[model samples]
Target: MKGVLVLENGSRFSGELIGCVRKGYGEVVFHTGMTGYQEILTDPSYAEQIVVMTYPLIGNYGINGDDFEAKRPWLTGFVTGETCDFPSHFRQEQTLDQYLSEQGIVGLTGVNTRSLVKMIREEGSLKGYILPANLLADGEKFDFPALPRDLVRRVSTKQTYQHSVQGESHVVLVDFGAKENIAGALTRLGCRVTVVPADTEFEQIARLQPDGIMLSNGPGDPADCADLLPLIKRLATAYPLFGICLGHQLLAMSFGATTEKMRFGHRGSNHPVQDLRSGKVWITSQNHSYSVRREGFPAELVVTHKHVNDDSIEGVAHSVLPAFSVQFHPEACPGPQDAEALFHRFLALMNERKGSQLVTTI
Candidate 1:
């Protein structure tokens, strides 16, 4: 069936409907990753966004159950230049079309994705809709509601859960729609992970007596989560705290720093980030729409990593507090694994704090 993608700016592209036939709408954004469609589809960070894959061909690897980042796909819609109906990977359980259909997501195939990407790059992110070609010709107006501010709440866990129970260090993950691979990564490092809701109070967290705290990646504006700022501030003061993506933005805001929406935000796996301490650049996986603003940044926080492309803040560490954050995914499911060592750095921070407490008690 024919489908048409209409941007808020009045631009339109007609293509074949490859997934569900229903219309979908959201802020239209593009990702440059050549692979990991499954992970990107399931990542909650893409909530309320219609994702356009810049890669000319998608779904070549097929969908596998093991690679899902979240329990369900959260993007408002999917767009691709071309989609493979038949996949060739051995672990493939089903085609991407089938997966998106099952998840009630609309997808457009054979689209001029390169052109859409270029437009987004030049005009910034846009709110758009994907509907059947018939709807476009029917003269019926199509308008989507404004994206909600409660995106994090819509995606975050409602209850706390545990993972990697047998691991040594106990870490509480404030799950603002966390990817499962993050817990998997910590588990691999012998850390017991307890995931809590986005609005989990500091008192509840304190009762867990966790050795470390993790602020997880999620969807939407960091300012929308103002209710959690006090909790983050309290936790950062008392524990070894680490954050990623949205969590990084929240952490910065907790310290009186501010965050701003990016112009066509970074959403690729091949971004280069320079580690300020080591003076080395590492390829990173990133997916976020907002970033920490440099003006009036907190004095206690020190820049640790920066994006090589725009010199944006990619990582920061508190001068005296055992807290740090990064805007990129170190757990890289479908990207280069070079940044995995950062998890080890987190582990080292936890261990050092533990040793100091042990000495103080003795």
Candidate 2:
């Protein structure tokens, strides 16, 4: 079967269908990670988007059940320069094509993925459609799926859930399509985590009496999630608060800060960021198309980290509050660990707060 990718700009590319033979449409984006295709595919951050892998070959190790970041692959479509037909790895359970098809994901191979990536790099992200070239070549207009405005709602869990461990501090996690590592990292740090839905009410969350709260990374436009800002504002003052990625954006907004979309956005593992306070540079992993607008930040909040590439804000801290956030992934599952200590930083803040509260009670 033939696969054709039609960009919103009307550019088209032809390739061979390798996974589920079905039409799909989404905002086309590319990832530069040479590894972690499975993690990227299942990452809810990719929800409602079509992903083009920049690496020439994919699925050399096949797919395993243990590495999924989301419930399933949320990407609307997949494209690759070449795909491995046979994979050899001890953990391999299924081939990439088999895995994607089983999950009802559409994939295209034998396409110039490098060229596609370059196009996205130059033009920024855009909506596109994928279908059989035979169906597209004759000038038939394929109806593109309505670009989703509520991507976060579609990806977020409807009900609250929990991940518990025997620990001193109880952390209430506001799940805005959180990555698994966020909870896993907390568990490793001697914290009991209760994962809640994105729209969890403040009164209900307060009843948990958690020592801290975490705003999680998620997909889509931050402005689309206006419903969460009030809840975040209410929770921030109730406990020690920390956020990451979309969580970071929401935190900024809760303090009356603004956000803006990037030209191409950061979506790779090799991004360089500098801790403004420590003057230390760290290679980090990042994956968000929008950023908190520096101009919109309140004076009460201080910029703590910045992207060395474009001089964009990477981290922020409140002047008189035990609240902070970073726009990068510190719990990177398939990327660099330079930012892993950030999880420790959040844990330390919680520990400090617990001590202060104990002292006050006495």
Candidate 3:
């Protein structure tokens, strides 16, 4: 069926509706990854947004069960230049259109995604809608509601769960719409992981007797998560901590640092980041619309890594506390694994803290 993507600025583009035939509305953003559509679709960090794939051809490999980053797709809509109808991958379970339809996700194809991306870049991100072609001809004004402030709550887990039971170190992961690969990466590092809801209290996490804590990636602005700052501050003091994406922004905020929305946020698999301490560079996967402001950062925090493209603050570490965070995904499921060493760094921090406490007792 014919479809039209209408931007809040009154711009419209015609396309083919490949998924559900329902109208969808949200903030429009673009991703540059050439692959990983399945992982991107299910990532909770895309919640309440309409994603535009800039790579042109999408879903050539088809959708497989193993590639899902979350239980379901959280984005309000999907946009692509073209989609593969007959996928030939050995692991393929279903076509992208079939998968999106089953999951109630609306998708648009045959649209000039490059032009859409350019518009978002030139004007900053905009609110947009995906509707049938008939709606455009009606010439009626559309008033889309503002994106929700509680997107994290809408995507976060409601209960605590355990994984990697036999691993040595006990780590409590505060699940703010976390991707499964984050837990998988922790388990691979020999950490026994316990995932708790985003609003899980400090007392509950403390009771877990964790060796370390992880603040997970999620949707929405970090300022919207002001309530979590106090809990994060307390946890940072009590345990070794690591954070990713939105978690990184929130952690910085807890230290009295500020965060601001980007003109066009980084959302791709191949961003280059340089480690300040070692002067080493690594390709990373990133997906966030806000970043921690480098100016007036807390004295206790030190910048560790920076984005090579825009010189944005990509990673930070506490000078005294065994806590650190990165604005990119080190547990990249559909991207390069160069940043995976960050997980090992977290484990080393936990070990160092344990040895220090043992020596203090002696």
Which model scores highest in lDDT? 1
Which digits, one per residue and each the tens of the lDDT, describe model 3 over residues 1-362? 99989999988878999888899899999999998889899999999899999998898999888978899999989999999999889999999999989999899999998888899999999999998898777986899777889788889999998967868788999999999999999998889999999999999888888999999999998898999899998999999999999889888889899999999899998899999989998988889999999789899999999999899999998989888999999999445576888898899989888899889999
Error of 1 at 19 (Å): 1.6
Worst 10 residues of 3 by lDDT: 333-342
The digit string of per-residue lDDT tens for model 2 on 326-351 reads 99888884455767777777778888
Could you list the CA RMSD of all candidates, in the order they appear? 1.0, 1.4, 1.2
Question: All candidates' lDDT scores?
Answer: 0.91, 0.86, 0.91
Q: What residue pairs are clashing in model 3?
A: none
Local distance difference test, candidate 1: 0.91
Give the clash count for each candidate.
Answer: 0, 0, 0
Candidate 3 ranges beyond 4 A from true positions: 333-336, 360-362
Q: Kindly list the per-residue Cα lDDT of model 1 for residues 11-127, writing each as its tens digit.
A: 999899977889898999999998989999999999999999999999999999899989998998999999999899999999999999999999999999888899999999999
What TM value does model 2 have? Answer: 0.96
